[model samples]
Target: MIRDIFENAYAAGAYSLAGVVLMAISFLVLDLLTPGKLRQHLWADRNRNAGILVASNLAGIAIIVTAAIVASDGRLVEGLTYTAVYTIIGIAVMAVTFALIDVATPGRLGELMLHPEPHPAVWVQSVAHVGVSLIVAAAIL
Candidate 1:
């Protein structure tokens, strides 16, 4: 029983670490797609558009990770692999979505993130991120 407990704890820890790493990757992806320094905009400037976009990206990652973990069904290796793969796919899709939006819209998407006022486009992009994540998550299941 104790061995089983230890194994479960280890699995949980591993999954958690994987989730955090994937989230970091997602953050970097978003940072790359946005203009200026993301940290500066998020921390010092406290830009609401950047904040909303980032929050949605992270939440999308969480949703993907959760779905991957659930689909693993107690298989650690498979879970980690799926989590990473799905998260990467999610990030790529989100980036492409951003690019598409930029093309279809009036101004540069990345530059708009730096705007002082909250832009409606940012909200649309944020929803797209979560929507793509949900599709990926559903695929995992």
Candidate 2:
């Protein structure tokens, strides 16, 4: 019984590691879409708002993955595969949605990321991330 428990724990660990790697990749994708490095903005520039938004995006991805794993139950391989696939799709959708938002708005989205002040647009962006995440999570589930 202990061995079974340990094996399940190991599987969960592996899948969680996969999720973390995917989130890192998603951050890179997001950074590329913007004018500046997101990590730089969150760290070097000390942009709290940017940090908040970026953190939310990461959380959004995590939420989807968590839901997927739960839905997958004991099927580790299937669960990890589904999580990775859906995450990639979610990232693509997010990039496109971000671009559309930039095009539809008055100012550059990248510039907004650099802004020291909090913008309503960031809130909207956060909502967009969650909305996309929920849809993707539902699909995976």
Q: What is the C-alpha RMSD of each candidate to the true structure, in Å?
A: 0.9, 1.1
Q: Mind giving the per-residue lDDT tens digits that candidate 1 earns over 1-141?
A: 999999999989998999899889988988999888898999999999999999999999999999999999999999999999999999999999999999999989999976889888889999999999999999999
Highest-scoring model, lDDT: 1
lDDT of 2 by residue, 31-79 (tens): 8876767778888989876886788789889988888798878888888
TM-score for candidate 1: 0.96
Candidate 2 least-lDDT 10 residues: 30-39
TM-score of each: 0.96, 0.94
